[model samples]
Target: MQKGAAERKPGETDDELLHKVGTGNWRAVRLLDYPVDRILEAAGAWKAQAAGIVKPWLVWCAHPDWAVLQQKLVLSAGWTPIVGFDPRVSHVPIVPGSLRIDFNEQLQLPLMYPHFPVELAFMWIDKIAFWHSDFLLAHDMMERVATQFESLPQGECFVTHPGHPIRTRLKWLLNAKDARYWELLGCTTKEASKSQWDNGTSWWMNFQDHPNCPDKVEYERRAKCYYDHGSGIRYWHQKCGGRVRFIYETEIAHGHFTKIGNPDFKRSIPAGQSDSLRLMEQDMSRNFGLVEAAKKMRIEDLLSSD
Candidate 1:
């Protein structure tokens, strides 16, 4: 084997090689077609680290004050919480039973582009469950999922979205198998459709929003490299031969719903949790945001005392 070349050792397992490439020990590997390599490569460039299983959920959070309460609930459930912090926000308070990471450090890139570090979390954790900072799991969430969480098959994923009965019915009627409504849903251009690739392409192709975005055909080719269907769950399921389970429930509460000013917007706050959310926000505002009332006291201030 050549020096500096990443050569597979005798009897080296796929999981071991996955760790190497994932941690940047091997930089980038090619020729050998492994599913792990393909998945991580699709996400982003390699970064330095050692890999090991950490938890079931990767919580991406920007505000520690807001997420601290949610973190406590996650810990009470005996579930591991890995918080992905947006580096720019450093005033996050330390919460127990949670591992905090910086997105800039992990991705080795700036946070200007809207991207999810799913590959990074998947490499360190057994399952890939990505949770937004604003969504708080119900008190009974872990207990409810204990059985299914344990029995979940390898390569399978479980996703939860804003569930509305009426919207769900309309979507089903439009997307049902052999349905004629599919014709009406077809997009004339790739940009017209929302896909996982939107994050990668938005920097260059979002002319109306970005204004400075280049209007070049070259960006389209770049977008294709990250392209996945709007039905990403289905695409990954078929590509990787895994099952994607959509948990249709109203239990997972979205914190933003409580603060939304738009009267027409639908809110999905779980039963009996609205008061808690309001109280938590009030406490944060009174204590953390009072000094810098214009903004708020940050995770840094919360941590400085500790």
Candidate 2:
């Protein structure tokens, strides 16, 4: 269990908030009944470390294998990547050219919630470019995107992809009760159902089931305030006077851990009792690479191969 996972009562004292920060438990601080922006403010000392870096590329990285490869690809294209990592990830890649933000020293909110980082990025830099570390883009496309974002006028923002809409739409329809799915549905204009918050990701601070959000009004406010990538882009677009645009030039290859493409990567699970033994070594090996390639291989050579 996570440290400081205790149920926080409503109207938590300032002392409690300070203690949570002092303990380096940003996850626990997230569960407190306060706005995320306020929580970020309280973490000023820790978060300020990254505030000085105002880079254009914000790469949200998780696993080392993917991050290493991504760093290679991005650097080869002549863009400086500002990579963000989950605080709890045991292995973070040490790429020389990339600026790294370890959420352990900053706010450890779920990176899946793109709004969190986008908001943070906007605090320091304008006209930012962001994508997942698992994404594979050609050198030409990277150059194109870098040039596109750099040339964006004030009050303008651009997103290269709309994401996998068909799969996401089906997932939302099948699991309408889940609020986590709602964010990705790109339906910010509609009212979200209460069940969506009730059956959402339990660890999310905004969900109805979370102990910190015991009050209906509080949870509702939290739920409504959340935004996924599509909603975030739209929100900024409207806020910036309709300057946001989605440009589809080249399709980016998302290297999903479960899927096979790279000859060095594959996901494997045991035959029976998949749920019970799903976390065994065999299953884990499938998702994670055996060695860190970013450090060993040449960037040009890695990008040259399929």
Candidate 3:
């Protein structure tokens, strides 16, 4: 019994995307209907925010559905897709750049949204998180790496995907460097770990049964425009059950509350009263510590064929 996708304001920053979880802004993170270029622009904008210099980081999600678009980006200008991975996805970790962006993002699409399929949403988020991260690196190779949205101190927002509580209690881990990455999918460091049940220490955004799992195509829609090229397009089956919706809703909830990585149930804050603004005082400035976001040099390695 999770809430439905919220409605977004006429024009909102990505930060508003998280409002639905706690502030109850009620806006759906609906980038699905927008044009592919729009998505690229969104990716580019976030990249500019993270990295001081605006270098084009050609990015595409690993999902096969986006394969055509990936090719187009590479062919049109300077863009490439790699250095991204989805646990549910196979054969990724595309390596065009020296830095690989990683992160988990959640969207609360309805079980019966006529136009969008949850699977597609998941693919998009997974890809965008990577895209944004690399976009930052592609831009000005800085000494410091900052997030697009205001960044919270490590353990400020704990996200976990199959996150481990035991690990949190221990707090022993270090990510690789020269590899610009974001835990977009849903992750939390030791400070952010909440004991789900002593089940595990990894704090993650746990949606009960996210429809994004890519079950079966609900129906086949003619690629109308793209079909002229004969690359058929398919959408997710909206007929999914509640389990699917529940999983997404759960993660949406966890993402907002525990974002600062204070997932401890006792740390719950009143909805709409979150410290997000204070949290994101700046878009992402190199002057800041960017604890999780460390900068890298050697921009050419990003698209390296290595």
Candidate 4:
């Protein structure tokens, strides 16, 4: 039988308990079933520490549910929220206290490339962060990123999660033609053959202080280069002079490949295994609510404008 919370040894801190749980100590398994409110409260407290260390300007591109969820997470994590979206879809509701940047109006790059809006947002803020919409952030994510940034070597342009190990290796074998493609871009053998370093899902940087910061025109040019080459990761690595460091962990849960059409996708929830499925459903419900609210507000604004 596992010991309950009340049975904890005297003077054992929550951090110590969590550490034990992380290390798979049997004594800590009882802590796994914490009440949801307790977890939220703990996360809320951690938010203060995250906010104090580095309050990044978040720039996101995604649909309504993702936008709302991302906004909620960042706000709770103590960061300013900024969203970039296609005005044509226009379904992403205006999140309270968030600045929305319309990618169609502000960015000249093609919609096929998702990172352009992030790059646009990157130019607007001193300390900026960009991440994919499908990621759910851990409470201490920003604090970790900030601490890593402070400890980075001088002249590093960004810090990001390491690219997926399997995919990074497979891309070279699968896309051998990229060898010539890379050479055409004037890449050295080291640069061409280097493992993909940054995954682009979550990264932070300050353009003002970055030694290789490109101007708007140059940024766009490089973006187009990435689009042409079909690899944003490669473009960042090459153009930034490979001055990127990998975080030990991104502290984000990725559901990017969970939807249909993915090889490993599975949507059906088994009995008593509702954690991930329940969260997805809850996010969808919230997203739908926000979309309806935005539509109603948009109609009212149009009537007033007329």
> lDDT values of the candidates?
0.37, 0.43, 0.25, 0.37
Q: What tens digits encode model 2's per-residue C-alpha lDDT throughout 110-166?
A: 322323344333344444466644345555655666666566665444554333546
Cα-based RMSD of the predictions, in order?
Answer: 15.8, 10.2, 18.3, 22.8
List candidate 4 stretches off by more than 4 Å. Answer: 1-54, 59-61, 106-114, 120-123, 146-155, 159-240, 247-261, 264-306
Angstrom error at residue 244, model 1: 1.4
Clashing pairs in 1: 91-298, 91-299, 91-300, 92-299, 92-300
Per residue, candidate 3 scores C-alpha lDDT tens digits across 219-252 of 1111111111001110111111111000122222
lDDT of 1 by residue, 77-172 (tens): 566655665444446565766766554453342221112344233333345344444444434554565445555665444555334546755875
Q: RMSD of candidate 3 to the true fold?
A: 18.3
Top candidate by TM-score:
2
Count of backbone collisions within predicted model 2: 1
Give the better candidate number (1 or 3) by lDDT.
1
Residue 191 C-alpha lDDT in model 1: 18
Pick by lDDT: 2 or 4, better one? 2
